[model samples]
Target: MKSSFFSILQRIGHAFMLPIALLPVAGLLLGIGASFTNATTIDSYGLQPLLGDGTILHALLTVMKSAGSVVFSNLPILFAVGVAMGMANKEKQVAAIAGAVGFFAMHATISAMLELNGLLAPDALPEGSLGMSVGINSLQMGVFGGVLVGLGVAALHNRFYRIELPTTFSFFGGTRFVPIITALSYMFIGILMFYIWPSLQEGIMHLGALVNRTGYAGTFIYGFIERALIPFGLHHVFYIPFWQTALGGSEIIDGISVSGAQNIFFAELASPNTQQFSVEATRFMAGKFPFYLFGIPGAALAIYHCARPEQRKLVLGLLLSATLTAVLTGITEPIEFSFLFAAPVLYVLHCVLAGLSFMLCHLFDVGVGQTFSGSLIDFILFGVLQGNPKTHWINAILIGIPLFPVYYFSFRFLILRFNFKTPGREDEGQETKLYTRQDVNAAKAQAQKGDQVSNLIVAGLGGSSNISHVDCCATRLRITVINENLVDDEMLKSSGARGVIRRGTGIQVIYGPHVTLIKSNLDDCLHNAV
Candidate 1:
């Protein structure tokens, strides 16, 4: 049961990575375009005023804004494709195509159901229904709807993909059967969703209201739970709805409606009335900036200073890159994972302190937004670029003053008093060797081709007979084998894996962002080998 739960949670996390990876570029485009096009920013930064209307730079900025906005606008389709690919064990293309068909069919079916129920409208549904806008005879189900359609297709595709058909129906035996099965299943789902979604939407609205009413206390809880759930890989399920659904926060800007706190903030920032919205509406994102930019790096310093003197040298490089990752990109897994396995209690303390920081930021009305992590990059683009009148950027410094020391000293005191392993103090038998990006790249170069890398990875994973399933997330190759004992960790490392993780029959080979290509190559190699 534990293994099954872990497997499911891991797959969800893997699915999230696909959409998550695209956010940084989108965010950058939005930030740059917003800053350049804003009259205030352009004037303050001394951009050419005469070039503003119909000029090349203005046209370019318009393109930039459209590029950024389109990603969020069409997020539903992206989620559908991402989730389908993430969940598929084989023939990712089949699952993705089926997921697309299922998405449209489900929305159409839901539209028909709602029309029959007399609840449908042209531009909006009755209150307590999903969708940002209404269309002819139907409303868009948004990202939440996309998630359901994707999961449905994946389930159907996985179960029936290999089923044998009678000779007369052999042409539709394999991948061809996936979309047919998915579309049929989703018709039933559409009917069910039409009835269930209203209440579900109402519940989500009430929950959002409760959180909003709680104010800073709500921010604290959100920040704490978001970090706390990372170990179990369930944080995305908790936050994405709040980030994308109407329940999170929504606003109609410049004759267009945008949902989610982040989306609303960006829309407002790009519009002339960036300062018009309530700062409190941005409470979700505001709380995270201080913790990511100040508190996490301090925690890293504490861990490093307390490490065994001899081993400190060994961990210094790890600590540096991990600290930079946390501060710049808001990616804290490297830093958090460093201490989580070594000192679980300390991890909880970290979460609690993070929660406190969130509350403090909200209490001070520090508003900021991020597409990815709450890193320095977002702090500058979202908070600083928009100027202090809107986001209260200086309040981050105020919150960070006490917040940083609290994380640093608390971590230090606990590590020393309890003699926690932290990182450098681990037992001799535990795997202490760390691999860097350079190491992975070198491994890749040594192999020269993806096939060679895949071959080595396959050999390391105990080859075709041993591997039961193969899949990948953003940065890791998720594989399951009949027997874990047959896997060779050294061979995997040499084959370009930065690290190897094992949980029962499940194994994940870490290879950073290039993992998708490696997974594709590995799939091909496995096919040819068989």
Candidate 2:
């Protein structure tokens, strides 16, 4: 029962990656556009001639900002479609269409309920009780509304997509029945929500208030658990609520009530009335800057310096590339996985430091925001470019600089004193590099001719016969197998995977950010082979 529940959670997390992947680009557009277009920022920098209202640059930025803001504004529908499609096993496009129809149906139904109850006006209901969903006057269920629709529709889709019916009604059977059923289900859900969601909203708001009351200690725990879940690939599931729902906190910006940490930060970014970014919202985010941008690189450097004298030359290029990736892109899995499996104690220490980073950043009131990860690009666009007075981005820098050496000296001491087998410190001929060149080359050579990676992955997972289901998340190919004993971890690693993770019948093959592409190709490969 526990494993089943865990497996479902893993699938949901994987499903979320589809929509989560879109955030970075949307944030990029919003951050860059909003920063340069802000009147105060323009005047402070004395760039009125270049970026002032009505100027060509200013007009283009306005368009960019709108384009980005639209994504956040319509996130519920996006999550609805993305999550439904992601969770579906087959006929995914059908699920996506159903998700959209259900979202509209649900909101429209709620709008009708409001009209019947004489609660259509904002003043007719309590403050923040009435809001819009895709222009439909309805309860402010936020992303939760979308998720509710998505999960429900996906379940309906999986159950009905291949269902058979009487010959007279066969036209509505199979994929055609999914959207039909979804619309009806969500219409009922909408009626239920109209009656129940106000109370629920109050509860969520109070919960958000309670979390805010926890202050710095709560922030520390948030950061600690976020990093700790990396090994299990469940960090997304852990962090999304705080980032997207009322659990993180809520605030009013430009007379608009914004719930969730990231929403508040971005809303403030877009509001011309903003004097400064909200520390309450950003405290959930700014902590990532220090650890991801500076501290992880420090740990990478430590691993390099501690390498065996003979292996130092070989490990330099690898560590350098990993460190650069972490510093610039905030993709730390490569560097993280090295010590994660080698010296778990070091990873624990890193998590503790990470918690402290959040608490300290909160204490200092650094109000940096992130599109997705704590990358240099996001740091500059959202933090540094937004100006020091507004974001207090310099405090993050001051705090982050010290973390570099702290991670360096501490990791160096721990590595040497404990003789941890991190990277180059591995026993001779025992997988020293993150991945072997020979295995990567073999996978590439086969791919040049055909779907070699997919074939190899199938073989590595004990052939197609052993597989029961397949899915993927941001960095891993998630699969469930019938026979765990048939799985070969070494073979999986040989197929360009960074590592193989096993939990009962569940298998996750780590492939970094490109796992989506691999998944698409593997899906095609499986279809063709079938």
Candidate 3:
């Protein structure tokens, strides 16, 4: 029972990646365009002649900003399609289409109910109580509504995609029945949400208020749990609500009330009337920048310095690459998993420091926002470019610079004192590299030939017969197997996984940020094998 629940949680978390993946480009376009078009920014930089109101540069930037804003604006529907497609066990494309169908049907039903209740008028409902969802005047359920539709539709899709029916209804028995059932089911759900969501919304608002009232401690706990869940691959599930819904707090941006931390930050970014960005909305995000940009690299440096002298040269390149990945893109598992399995004490310390970073940033009122990761790209686009007056981004710098040595010294002490077998200190003859590379060339060669890496992974997973599900998150290939005992951890490691995490039926093979490619190859491999 525990395994099944863990498997479901992993699946839902993986499902979130489909929509969350779209944020980077959208954020880039929005950040650059908003930065250039802002009157304050233009005048501050004295580039009026080149990028003034009527200039081509200004006009183009305006278009760019709008393009980015549209994605954020439509995230609910995107989540609907993404989650359904990600969660469906079969007929994924059909499930995706059904997700959209259900989303529209649900909102349309709620809109009808609101109009019937005379609650659709401009003043009929309290401000921010009734808002739009894909142009439907509906209750403000936010991304939660999209998620509800997606999960419900995917459940329906999985149950009925292969279902048989009476001869008279046989035409709609299989995949066709998915969308038909989804639309009808969500109509009832919409009616249910229409009646109950108001109270739920009130409760959510109170929860957000309570979270806000917790202030520094709240931010620390948020950051702490986010880092703590990394090993479990459930951090996305933990943070998505704060990033996308009322749980992160809400504010009126450009006369439109925007909920969620990222939403408020972006809306404020696009608004010309904005002065300083909202620190409250950004507390959930600013904390990541410091740790990702500085602390992780510091820890990497400590690992390198602690390596055996004879093995230092051999491990330097690997450590540098891992640190660079974390610093530039905010993907830390490569560096993290290196010591996570070897020296869990350091990981615990890292999580504690990460929490402190969040608390400090919140205390300083740093307002830096991020799209996906706290990479230098996001830092420059959303923080540096937005100006310190708005983001107080320099505060993150001030907080982070000192954290560097703290991480280095703390990690160094822990490694030496505990004699933690971190990278180079491994027993002689064992590879000193973090996350093994012994099979990289072989894995690449196999991938180029026919993705035999997938075959090895399949064998490692005890063949397709024992496997129940296969999915992935940002940096790990998540799977579920019937018999965990049959799984070979060493085989998966040799197939290029940095590490393997096993909990009953659930397995997560860490493969860094490019796990998506691995997942794609495995999908093809599985198809051919079947």
- What does candidate 1's lDDT look like per residue over 158-197, in tens digits? 9999988999999989999998888888888878887787
Against the unseen true structure, what C-alpha lDDT does each candidate score? Answer: 0.76, 0.86, 0.90
> How many clashes in each candidate?
0, 0, 0
Candidate with best lDDT: 3
Residues 1-530 of candidate 3: C-alpha lDDT, one tens digit per residue: 88888888889998998999999999999999999999898899999999998999999999999999999999999999999999999889999999999999999998999989889777887788876889987887788888988899999999999989999999989999999999899999889988999899999999999999998999999999999999999899999999899999988877887899998899999899989999999999999999898899899889989999988997888898888878898888889999998999999999999999999999998999999999999999999999998989999999999999999999999999999999989997877765334345555677999787798899999998898899888778999999999999999988777789988899999877667778888988888878
Candidate achieving higher TM-score, 1 or 2: 2
TM per candidate: 0.85, 0.96, 0.97
Better of 1 and 2 by lDDT: 2
Which pairs clash in the backbone of model 2? none
Off by over 4 Å in 2: 435-442, 449-453
Instruction: Find the 10 residues in a row with the least total lDDT in model 3.
Output: 434-443
Off by over 4 Å in 1: 48-51, 114-137, 254-257, 276-281, 308-314, 426-435, 445-466, 472-529
lDDT of 1: 0.76
Provide the global lDDT of candidate 3 against the true structure.
0.90
Q: Estimate, for each residue in 1-530, the C-alpha lDDT of model 2 and write its tens digit.
A: 55556667778888888888888999998998999999888989999999998899999999999999988888889889989998898889999999999999999999999999889865888776666788898888888888889899999999999999999999999999998998888889999999899889889888878878899998899899999998887888888888887777877777777778888899999998888899998988999999988899899889999999988887887888777878787888878988987899999999999999999999999999997789899999989899898889899888889999999999999999999999889897775676334444554566677977898899898888888789987568989888889999988887778788887677889876567667887877877868
